[model samples]
Every structure is written in C-alpha cells, then in structure tokens.
Target chain A: MDVDIDKIPKHLLRFEYPIFEFNKAIIDATHQYVVAYKPNMAFYEANGLKGWKSLEKTIKYLNKNYPEVFTIADAKRGDIGNTSSMYAKAFLKDLDFDSITVAPYMGKDSVEPFLNFEDKFTILLALTSNEGAFDFQTLSTQDSPLYKKVLETSKTWNYAHRLMYVVGATKAEYFKEIRSIVPNNFLLVPGVGAQGGSLQEVCKYGLNKDIGLLINSSRGIIYASSESDFSEKAAVEAKKLQLEMKQILENHF
Target chain B: MDVDIDKIPKHLLRFEYPIFEFNKAIIDATHQYVVAYKPNMAFYEANGLKGWKSLEKTIKYLNKNYPEVFTIADAKRGDIGNTSSMYAKAFLKDLDFDSITVAPYMGKDSVEPFLNFEDKFTILLALTSNEGAFDFQTLSTQDSPLYKKVLETSKTWNYAHRLMYVVGATKAEYFKEIRSIVPNNFLLVPGVGAQGGSLQEVCKYGLNKDIGLLINSSRGIIYASSESDFSEKAAVEAKKLQLEMKQILENHF
Candidate 1:
C-alpha cells in the first residue's frame, strides 16, 4: 500500500508517525483480501529520513503480524555491478522485503545481483504503465521491440528463475506477446484502476496455468477516501477488487 | 568517494560515524583536484538508517564546506511519472544534491520531471561501463544502436538543455559517436582505473568545445589504502588523475 501524507485522513496527522499509522490501519482493514502489500519507495524517500522510518515500521509490522502476506519494495533501482549488489542486499536482505522492482536499462550484471538472494524475487520493468513507456520500450529493434529484447535477454541471466516482469495493465494487448516469452513467470501488472486499465482486459491475456498475474491498483484503493474513515473506505475498495479477482480466478480454473 | 565499511581503515571504524569521517578526510585532501564528488546511493543504503544519516551528514558537509564543487547522487533511478517526481524531489530538492544519474528505460515523462528543476542536471544513462551494457544498449535498432537512439531521443525532451548522458569510459570508441549527438552536454564517464577504462582514450573522442566529461574513478581512488593513512593515499591517487587531466587539457586546447 502506497501512502501519501497529503491524502491521509486529517485526524491521523496528529499522531507521532502518521504514515505508519495510516499504513497499519489500511493493512488491518484489508490484509484478508490481499495477498501482497507493495509500497513504492518514492513516496517514502520523498519525505527523507522520517519517510524511511515509516517504511521500516510498516515492513516490520507486516513481517510480525501478517507473516504469510508477501511484501514488495517497488523501488525501480538498477546500477552497475557492485552498486547493484549493494542495493540487492539493502532491500532484499536488510530491509527484508520479499521482492523489489528493478529497471533493465543497465542489462545483465545490474539485475543478476538481485536474483542472487535465495527466495527474494526481482521484478524487472519490461513495459511500464506511463505515457513514457512508448518512448524507448516499444522502439523497433532488429528482431522485436526493445521490451521484447529485454525479456528475451534477461531470461538467460544467472538465477533467472527468481525474476518476475512488470507488464502494465494499460498495455494488456502486449501481455499475450509477453507471456509467449516468459509464460511461467509472475507478472506484476500495475496500471489498473486509477491508470485507466481494465482488469478484465489484463486478466484475459495475462493469466497462465499458474495464474501468473499480480494486478496492482495503488491510488484507486488506498486513497479511496480522505476522511476519518479512510481505512474503512480503503477496505471497501480493496474488497471490490478482491471480489473481481476471485470471480476471474474461479472462471479461469 | 564510495565508503565501504569493509574497505575502510580499522581505525576510522572506531569513530561514531566512519563513513562521514572518511568522506570528510577524503574531501579535505582531494577537493582541490576534483570538480565533483559522487556517492553512489547503494553504498549508503546498504547500511540502512545509519548509512542514510551518514549520507545526510556528508552532503551537508559538502554543501557547507565546498559549495563550489558539484555533488552527484549516483542513484540510477527512474520509474513511472508520479514516482519519478518523488525521487526527483527527494534527491534534488529535499536532499539538495546538485545532480543525479537516472536510467532512461522509462522514457520522457519519467525524466522530464527531473529537468523541471532549474540549475539541477539530470544525467541519463546511455552507454554504461558494465559488460551487461551489450545486452540491450548496443542492439541494432531501426536507425542506430540503442544507446545512440537513447541519446538522440532524449535530446528532444522537454527541458533538453538540462540533460546529460553517461557514456562509460571503457567504451571509448563510442564516445566520438556520443559526442556528435550531445556536443554541448557533459557526460559522466565512469569505468576509469579499477574498471579498466583509460582516461586518455575517453578524452580523445569524448571531449567537446566545453570539455564535456565528468570522469569518475570510485574504487581506484577511494579505497587506495586500508591502513590508517587511507585518506592520504587517496589524495595521492586523486592528484595523479588531476595532473593527467591537466596535461591532456593543455595539449588539447
């Protein structure tokens, strides 16, 4: 769950750590309906040290109370070899998140370091949900689009089994082509709800025999209300999406 | 300087904050020779909250003591629109670094927010130093290599004037081609020294009318010695690169 302090309920602002409190309330309200709780690092890092503290508290709360629930650190970080290794250790080992999103611009060595962690998953950005995804991701290469090349090339790296791909819900049409390359891998689809992507459209082509799709809708559910009953409202929104996914899963099976 | 606790002198480790102390000594010795001091976020992040506190102290020290020198947060970060903006604010505004290195895979909107900040430069990754750079960067695109396309396409971005490119010093042959595309922009050239890149070769083609290059040698200089005189040894190494650059500049202009 991504928490923006500005959008948080006014009453919660009086607490010593509002972000952490808001996150706790949301998790308590919606944990039963969701399998994973992904916190985008940007929102936390933007607030500097306090933001980081909230992140630490939130993750600790999850591991302690909801140990079975998966957690994702949606930090699209990638760098050169040694640098990447440090980041891998920081998030996956130190912070102890189950997965962290990474960018593929630096290629093999930059990403493989993250995969070295035993059970940790590295979600690599294949096709993003933003307008900018059209900028370089879909560029015509000799054999296929650049995103396709990323998927193809990355599959050969060491510890490839630990990797997952981020395919935007907005680009549902591309899911068929993406699944053709890496059908078994779990796809973190993030552009649904607020980003204007249809849940039905993404699930139609994104699902595999393993039900390999993690459809994410950050703002749509988390920021469902700005009043004192924000967490309850968020749970309502989360329940709606959960019911939709439940129906999709039952029908698919 | 990249401060690795394991590589630091045993004596400094006793200090309350070894990373900050090591950075201060290194800056005191080498500040006169270097135009910029870049601390890769990975190094600071690996240590967790204490690491972040050390980074904050280091940056604050630089801004106060050596205000003229440029500081780079070598965090090759990029993401969707709103997310990228948060990173931009955290590093450029909140943390107040002069510049940051960003990955270009996410495209225009992901990068444009960084450029929106006046006087702050956004260094976009083009040709990286790592072996994995060949994975997608050198792919045969419709017109040119992927890195070249990155350089060409990024040049037309919203605040194009604020953009810089990262062309690894290891790939010196590509510098002439890179310079042709970004003649006026500064290129953050890493891979010299320990990474096996030759400064003279990178300068041969990478230099433009503005002498556009920020040659970086992190490990080679920072970890010069593991003994108590580490900072002194670091100064000697920094001096060697500075003298070499001085001679090259005198010969060229």
Candidate 2:
C-alpha cells in the first residue's frame, strides 16, 4: 500500500497534529491486512524539512510496531553510478526501506549501485499506471516494446535477483505478454481500485509460481472517507482487498 | 555545475567538518567564473536528514552570498499529476531552487506542475550523457526519436516558456538535430570536462542567439585537487571553462 500523506481526509486532519499522527492511525488500522507499507517520498518532501521529519517518524513507527511488514520508499530515484550509490544509502541504508522505486531511463550504470546493497530490493518502473506510461514505455523498436527492452536489458545486470518491476494493474492485458518476458520476478502492481483496474483481471495474467504480486491501493484505502470513521473505513477497504488476495492465493496455490 | 558532494577530494574531507563547509569554499572560489550552481540532490539525501540539512544550508549560502548565480536542484523527479505538484513545491518553493531537472518519461501531467511555477525553470531530460541513454531515449518511431517526441509533446504543455532540455555534451552530433526541434530553449549540457565531452563540439552544434547553453563540469572542477589548495585548483578549472565559453561567445556573437 502506498501512503500519500497529503491525501489524508479532513476528519483525520481535524486533530491538528503532525502528518505522522494520521499515518499512525492508518497503520494501526490497516497493518494486519498489508504485506508492505509504501510511502511516496514526494508527499513528505513537498512540506520541506518538517515533512521529512514526519517520514522518518512514520518509518520508525512502522519498524517499532509492525516488524513483519516490509517498508518501501516509493521515491522513483535514479542517477549515475556514484550518485545512485548515494540514493541507495539514503533509502536502503539511512531510511531503512526494504526497497525503493527507480526509473529505468538512465539504464545499467544508473541502477547498478542500488542492487549492490545486500538484501535490499530495487523496483524498476516498467509500466506505470499514469497516462504518461504511453509516452516512452510503449514505444516500439524493430525488435520489441521499450518496456520489454527494459526487462531484457536489466536482467543482464549484476544482482538481478534483487530486481522487481512495476506493472500497473490497469494494464492487465499486457501482463500475459509481460509474464512471457519475466516469468519468475515479482511485479508491483498499482492502480487496482482508484484507477479502475480489476484485481481479478490482473491476477489472470500476472501471477507466477512464487505468487508474485504486491498490489497497491493508495487513494482507495488511505482516503476511503472524509468523516471521523476514516481509519475504520480504510481498514474495511484494505480488508476487502486482502480477502480478495487471499482468495486469489488459494486459487493459484 | 552539478555538485556531487561525495566527489569532494580527500584534502577537503580532512577538515572533519560538515559538507557545506567544503561547498562554501568551492562556491567562494568559483562563483565569479560561473553563471549557475546545480547540486545533485541524491548526493545530499544519501547521507540522510543531516545531509539534507547540508543541502538546505548550501542553497541558502548560495542565495545569500551570490544572488546573481542561478541554482538548479538537479533532482530528476517526476510522477503523476498530484505527486508532481508536491515535488514542484519541494524544490521550487520549500528548497527555493531557481530551476529543477525533471524526467520526461511520465509525459505532461508529471511535468506540467513544475512548469506551473512563475519565474522558475524546468529542464527536462531529453538526451543524457550516460550509457543508459541508449536504453530507451534513442528508440525511434517512423516520425522521430523518443527524445524528439518528448521535445514536441512537452512544447505543447502549460507554461512551456519555462521549459529547457538536457542535451548531453557527449552527444555533440545530436545537438544539430535537437536544436532544429527546440531552437530557442536553453540546453543544460552535462558530460563536459571529466566525462570526456568537448565543450567546443557541443557549442558548435547547440548554441543559439542567446548563447543558450549551460555546460556543466562537476568532477573536473570540484575535485581538481586533493590538497589544501583544492579551492584555488577548482577556481583555475572553472576559469578555464569560463574563458573557453567567452571565446565561443565572441566567435558566435
């Protein structure tokens, strides 16, 4: 689940507390139903240093309370080799995220440093849920689509085992073709609820032997209601997805 | 110039001081020979909250002491519509950067929020100087290259006047083709000096009526020496580039 802090509902904001308070409520309510907590860095960063403090607190809260839940920094960060190393340290080392989202635009050297970390994962943006995914991701060469090229080329890099790719749930039809290219790797699927993607349709083509999928629902679960029952509403929304996921696991396994 | 803070020499590191102290000396030494200072955010963020504090201090130092010099937050950030708006605030509003480098992979909504700011510039990644540039940037359709498509499509976005493009110094030959597409916009050219790109070649094909180029040399200038004379050495390097730029301006103008 991606926690976009700014999108917290009005009832939650009425407490006149820091953003972490809202995050705490959400985590307390929904942690049982989630395998991971993914927080997009931009939302916290937008508020400046104060925002970062909240992010640090939120991550600490997750680690201290729910040690079993994996934490992801959905920063979408990548640069050159040395620079990428710095980002790797920032998220994987300093912030203690299990994984960080990266853009594949810069290629091999840009991503290599992130993979160098021992146990940490690097999730490359394969096919995003937004309209912009059509811009360069779907563009074709003489051989294959650009997204396919990303998968093929990245597999050749060092520490390829730590690699995962993001495939939007909205692009469920492409999952069959995507699975043909990367059959073993996990796919972090976004856009299931708010973006109108069907969980059932995504699972039909995306599942692998490892039951590889981390379906994220941000706005749908985190911003479920604007009233005082926001956390309860969020829990209900997450439970619905969790139950669906449990059913899918049983069917596939 | 993109200041990758970790690249500062061993001599400067001997001080056992905060990173901003080294940056202060570098800026004091080289400010006269430069028009702008671009700090790559990953370098600072990698060190965690303390590193970000150094970044905040560095930017404040530049703005306080040298108001004439433009500052670019070379953080290649972009996301969906609402998320991008947060990044715009993080860099342009909270951090007070004069400009920011953005990735065009997400298309309009991801970039439009950055451009929405008045008087701030948004430099889109068109052609980067790294090996990863070949991964997706060069993929061509029947009409033009993906980078070209980015230039054409982004030109139609809101606040297009605030836009610029990153044309790597390594791809001097492509500048001719790129300039034809975006003739008037400034190009932030990296890969000069230490990256083995010829400043002369880039200016030959990239310059416009405004001498529209910000040729960046990061390692070549900042890590010019590993002794106490580091600041003076950096000044010498920056002066050399400035003189060459002046000669290029004289010949072209």
Candidate 3:
C-alpha cells in the first residue's frame, strides 16, 4: 500500500505506531519508484491494539486510495501448522494484506500454511540487522551459515514461489553472498536510514533482476519528524531513498 | 486472568477463540497457584486486531474480576530506548498489563524502559523451548548462552527484582545447569505435554523452593476437547498439573 504522507491525520505521529502517515506519505512521494510497501507489523503493534486498528484502517485506506499498490504486512510471523493457518487467516483473511513477513525457524509445517494462499506472499526472516544475527543466522553447521540452509530448505516447499526473504540493509555486505544463493526471489530489505544502513551498498548486491527489493525505512521515514510536519518530512526522506532507488532500477531495467 | 475454563462461553469451544476460553477456564482452576497469568502476547496477536481486542478484554477481565492475579503481557519486546518507552505506554498504559515479557537480545537500553515500571514485571526471554534453542542459547560466548548474561546483567536494573525468565519445559535436561545460574527467579515455561515436554522433567531441574514456574499448557489443555466440554476438560487438565505442582512444592518446602 502506498501510504501518501499528505493524507495522514496529524494526531497519528508516533515511532511506536508505524502509521499510515508514513506508508501513505512514503507511497505518495515514492510508490512509482518502488514495487511494494512493507509495514513492519511490530512497529504498529508496539503501539498496542489501537495502533493495530490504525494499521487496519491504513491498509483499507490504501486499497481504496491506491488499488495498484501492493500491500505487505511485515509481521515476521511463523508457527506450527495449526497456528500458521490461524495467522494466515488473520492477516490474509481478516486484514486482507497482500503479503506477510515470517520467521522460518520452525521448518516446513510452520511456514507452508502461509504459502497455501494463491497470490499473497511470505517473506521469511533470512538475515537480520542485529549483532545477534551472527549468533544463530551466521553460525556454520556444514560450511554455510544457517540462513543459507533456511534458504535452501525453503526452496522445497511446493507453494514457496510466493516466497521472499528479509535481508537487512545493515548486512548489505553479505547481499552479494546471499544473492548468489537465491538469485531470483524478491528480498525485503530493512535496517536502512535511521537504522544506520547504507542504501547504496544494499542495492549493489541485494537487488535482483526484477528490481527485486522492498526496502523498508520505518523510523527514518515515519518517525522522521515527531512534530506536526512529520508526514511532510517522511515524504522528503522517502523521496531521497526513492531517487536513489530509481537509479538502481534504471541499471537493471 | 481467571481463564474461565470450567464454564467456557459456548461460542469459543471449537478452538474458535481458544485463547479466550482456555485462559478463562485455566484462571478459574489455577488462580490460586499463580500470582500472575501470562498469555504470550504473540498468541493473541497472531489472530490479528480482533484477537488483540480479546487480549484487551482478557487483561481487563483479570484486572476487574481477578485483580490479585498479576497480568503479564508476554510480548518478549525489546527495542531502542525511545521505542521502548512507547512500548511501555502501549502495554502498561494502554493494555494495563501488570507485567510483560522482554527480549534481552539488544542490551541495557533495550530492556531498561520496561523495568522502570514499579509495579510491572518484565520477564525476559532467557531460555526458550524450541529445538533451535541450542543454536544460540547454549553458545559458549565468554561463559554461556546469551541468556546467562541476561540473567546476570538484569540483576543491576533498579527494578530487576521484578524480572523473570522464560525457561522452556523441554530444557529440563538443563535443570542442574539452570539451578546453578539462577536459584530464585521465576521461570515462565511453555512446551509442556502437547509440545513433548515433560512436567516431571521440568520440575526436576526447574522448580525453585518458591514454586517459581508458571508452566503454561495452551494447546494441550485448551484443545483437549473441541466440543463444549473443552472448559471442563481444561479445568481437569489444569488441576492435574496443579496437583503435580503441589506435590513438587511439598517436597521442596
């Protein structure tokens, strides 16, 4: 969903609440430059259920406002089969999001339920931005970090074509290594801007031929200005990233 | 909350809204055994915004009807400082949960905001029940898995005395391993019966003299019967676990 910054209500500015203001403003300023909007569900959820209500309203507003924009719920959810089915029902059925971010730690049964949906996508947590990313994600079992094995194993899930991955911008250094493993699939890049991630380095290796990157800039854009001009500043910040992304898309196209 | 399992409202019996019914019934049965009832915030959330409302009601119900039960919003939340403050507002102010579960992955700044609450507890995710647990939890970084460092570091937080740890039921093998590290703190354990975790094993290694284990049996007890008999069965299941716990406490005292 392209969250047009100008369309947001002023009272909704919050870091905890990754509001439609961020999504709308960013989309208003940059949707033409990018293919998807990945609103990390945690950002809105951290605001309590009210923030979630805002998110639902935001997504509905987007569907009505920008039918062309793809909606990705950056939820990072994955669980046992029955649980995943319920999750899929929650986000895909009730919320009507186009995609969801998932954690593939529980293997097939946990992730497959999300994949069962026809067009909705599941972006699995591959390599994160934190220092602890090195803890379990990069730990070597047979010569490859466990993240690689996750990518390799994920390929076997039948309905996995709708799958994508989360490769943090902070780990842009490993994008080249990651792309070599799963070259064709889309990647949702987070940890850009306010998180100290370099957009230039991330595009260099993470971008696939489809201009395949949904780079999420949460705090940097949404919480750009805590004051009344927050939405406008978010547009400015989003435009900056979009301009850089436009050049990256040009090279591939 | 008094998880009103004994006489569940008819609508929620078919695992339709299991957390609601299960929580209610369990509370009715085990409120005496626990000072706190922590339904993993993730479980309710996995159901999306509507599920979030149920959580709100659950917390409200506990505060209204069973005020003695300290409600823990088990979100396993940990983020940057300002973000953490907003989260504090989300749960403490918005949801009004008496406690919360935090992730200690980030360090002091990530956990401190939650600890600032005088009445609220922040139960850190120290040791989990998942198989991937060995991937990081047991890593010999300087001394032990990051969990040990969490337990030690948390000791210095001003209200860290209110802190707890999520030690899994399956990790009872590390009973002696854990006892040596933390002798007094409460452990919120999942992975009982339904998850192939043994109650005997968990108590063997995990029970402190204070009966410091809020061992949650969600699926096993709640889903024990899909019919209207669910609550009755849930009460039966909870009583069985509580009885065993009573014996364990008897031996300890």
lDDT of each: 0.91, 0.86, 0.70
Instruction: Please identify which of the two predictions, 2 or 3, would achieve the higher lDDT against the true structure.
Output: 2
- Candidate 3 — what's its lDDT? 0.70
**Tens-digit lDDT string for candidate 3 (B131-194):** 6455444554454555566567667767777888887788788766777777888888888887
Compose the digit string of candidate 3's lDDT tens values, residues A216-251: 776666566656676567678777888888887777
**DockQ of candidate 3 against the true complex:** 0.23
Ranking by DockQ: 1, 2, 3
Question: Taking the tens digit of each residue's C-alpha lDDT, what string does model 2 give over B150-207?
Answer: 8988888888989999988988989999999899999999999767799989999999
**TM-score, chain B, predicted structure 2:** 0.95
For each candidate, report its DockQ versus the true two-chain complex.
Answer: 0.88, 0.69, 0.23
Instruction: Give the better candidate number (1 or 2) by TM-score.
Output: 1
TM-score comparison, 1 vs 3, better candidate: 1
Reference-based lDDT, residue B35, model 2: 94
Off by over 4 Å in 1: none
| Interface RMSD over true interface Cα atoms for each candidate | 0.7, 1.3, 5.0
Better of 2 and 3 by TM-score: 2
Rank order (by TM-score, best first): 1, 2, 3
Best by DockQ: 1
